[model samples]
Target: MTATTHTRHDPAAATLLRFATAGSVDDGKSTLVGRLLHDSKSVLVDQLEAVEAASRRRGQDVPDLALLTDGLRAEREQGITIDVAYRYFATPRRRFILADTPGHVQYTRNMVTGASTADLTVVLVDARNGVVEQTRRHAAVSALLRVPRLVLAVNKMDLVGYDEAVFAAVADEFTGYARRLGTADVVAIPLSALEGDNVVAPSAHTDWYSGPTLMEHLEGVEVAAGSPDAPARFPVQYVIRPQSGAHRDYRGYAGRLASGVLRPGDTVTVLPSGQRATVAGIDVLGTPASAARATQSVTVRLAEDVDVSRGDLIAAGAAPRLTRDVTATVCHLHERPLRTGDKVLLKHTTRTVRAVVREITYRTDVDTLERRDAAGALDVNDLGRVVLRTAEPLALDDYADNRRTGAFLLIDPADGTTRSAGLVGETSAWGAP
Candidate 1:
């Protein structure tokens, strides 16, 4: 199969991917990340020395790789990661941005915030413990968020003597449960995160395993390429008119492409107003591209003036669905529960509007996947179906269709803080009585 070529700001680098890690306490999530970075030669000598020094202070022979990820003083004292720590590293093959997140029950909200923009998720599992509740919780969140790819890293093989049976058992249990959560792909790898085994370099100790190493799998995974002819959806961010002498007629509509490919001479429409125009050109960081794809930032120039503004979607071919009614499944994060009849702000893509909680469907029991009718509303860490009536129409898609356009965040109108995360789906059958 021929690999799809992605456009990069610098022709030298291929593309950048963002991923997040989740697991239970002592499951070796941080150690796995630290080892991946260290074995990839992404760490500097000074950083390595600091980790070693910290290890010695904790009375350890080998340096604790987890310390490299848990950088905050409070996190170090608690021996856990509290906030999301983003790390950047690049190999000759690809560049990566990793979001290292916390594992405890109280910090589930933080995990959601970190994994919101992730294209893939790495769910670490302790080989000794097999499939635990924490593993299930992380998998549930990954499914709820609709992450495209999933990698199950079964850490601590050394303690289990690199036993193939142990690896298979953990892999089977985790994969079985993950399948129920709607995971698309699950690749299992047995490794000792602390020993640099099968992280960056292939592990000779695991001749029984025949899969690609963690780093190799990541580098070779086929991410979705840009769509060239799909419906164009550009939520206008801000209008840019340089007003400089060199470019006085430069009326640039600034925003990231939500879907489809756009090029010059294409006929386009502005949503909510039904105005139509032709594309004159595209600008990327002051340069023009023959075409641009979804997720790329660009300024689109229209051949004629139409009433365009921020929050309006500029589309090509067909327009996205616009309505004030939204039925979605949401995971409540804040301490306060989201009850029926409460008014909140639903932020979908770049559009924000008032949304009333029309109904509370069934609250899903995480462990059993059973619908519970007893709960009046969803509390923290609870998943439930919700019916919301927005004050205005939103150009939105189904969560299963386009994650970028289908997903949304509920903000507290009183305090301006995010309260819940939602995915478009049928809420009628799932709602509570």
Candidate 2:
């Protein structure tokens, strides 16, 4: 008897949370992240020693925790974060992938990249400054990305005399603004990243406050487990066929499931061709599988020899819309401006197709949540709407409904540089078209 090996999907691994941090200049985003790592015992001895030595060179008595995250030499020298720094840490309760983003306005595009895949975002605000324009901008970006959870870390509490009233006011203002931006799950916590108050352990200063510590909230927060009812979407990346082996007759469509679950005997439709086929088998890492969930890479064998190729979508349940005209919300990432009638490459899922920028609809004002239509082109870090005409039809889902299948990127065909990140639906506070 041939013993079959099955892929074991561990439930504990689902506790892994991907989160990002954003703030204005000197809001102590790096300090807060460093404090989290240090307090969580994720920092190494050599790394701490290096930070201590660097702090001493700057005539500081205490080690600058911020140095732990500001890895770039330019950032350390300038005393600011110039790029996104990613770190990994784990606790008994959960594991985390942290993207500590830059605070400078010029590097807002870096924040977009970090927070795009984050399940939660920590938006820092200095207690003394309350809520500033950059605070609003970070919140707006978090909302735009559809981040499931938000943490308003009112930092520098010690600098404000650990005043409960100050924390309350800042929390109220930020929460109200976040609510207006359509973000409902906002958790506000007051802490001092410098003095280590209420970050890992609960602080004794705030006697009136009865909320959990930052670490507690992060560990306990519910990570979204994708709904099983969602339509299964698998964008064919590679067609596997062995011409000279025992499996010569076997042909499989390989890709990661974008959402929902796929199982054998499920009826699926091949997009762009509209061919119907049944899932005859599901293989995970060369092992036969009974089912494959979202984000899992697997090879699917169809009962019929369909003409499905790379870039084709195999969908089960609700079908995605097929269209060549795409209206999307985009964030320009490159220094080169995105103008009307510019020919570019639109990469969606595993497919790359030629596309033209039909129009620059409007640029969004992050501060005021206003849509400005006068702008003829989208500049670096500019969030706006645009119309794209593609050379080939694409199967797409609304970004609001499915983050995986509903997102795409605009690439410069000349140099293959990524110009913008786009979402396939209107994403704004005013709900304007």
lDDT of 2 by residue, 122-161 (tens): 9999999999999999998989989978888999998988
Question: Candidate 2 — which residues are off by over 4 angstroms?
Answer: 1-14, 73-82, 431-433
TM-score of candidate 1 on Cα atoms, chains taken together: 0.90
Candidate 2: residue pairs that collide? none
Residue-level lDDT of model 1, residues 1-433, one tens digit each, is 1112222233255677788999998898878888988888998999999999999999999988777776642563664323677889998877888887788876776677777778888999888898888788787777777677788899999999999999888887877777666664788888888888888887888999877778887777766644566677788998886597979878989999988888999998887787889999999999998987898999999989888888888888766677788888887888889999899999987878899998987777665667787256888877788889998888777877666777888999999978899988652221223
Per-residue lDDT of 214 in model 1? 85
Model 1 pairs in collision = 361-431, 361-432, 362-430, 362-431, 362-432
**C-alpha lDDT (0 to 100) for residue 241 of candidate 2:** 81
Using lDDT, give the best candidate's number.
2
Looking at candidate 2, the ten consecutive residues that score lowest on lDDT are: 1-10
Q: Give per-residue lDDT, candidate 1, residue 393.
A: 83
Best by TM-score: 2
Local distance difference test values of all predictions, in order = 0.80, 0.87
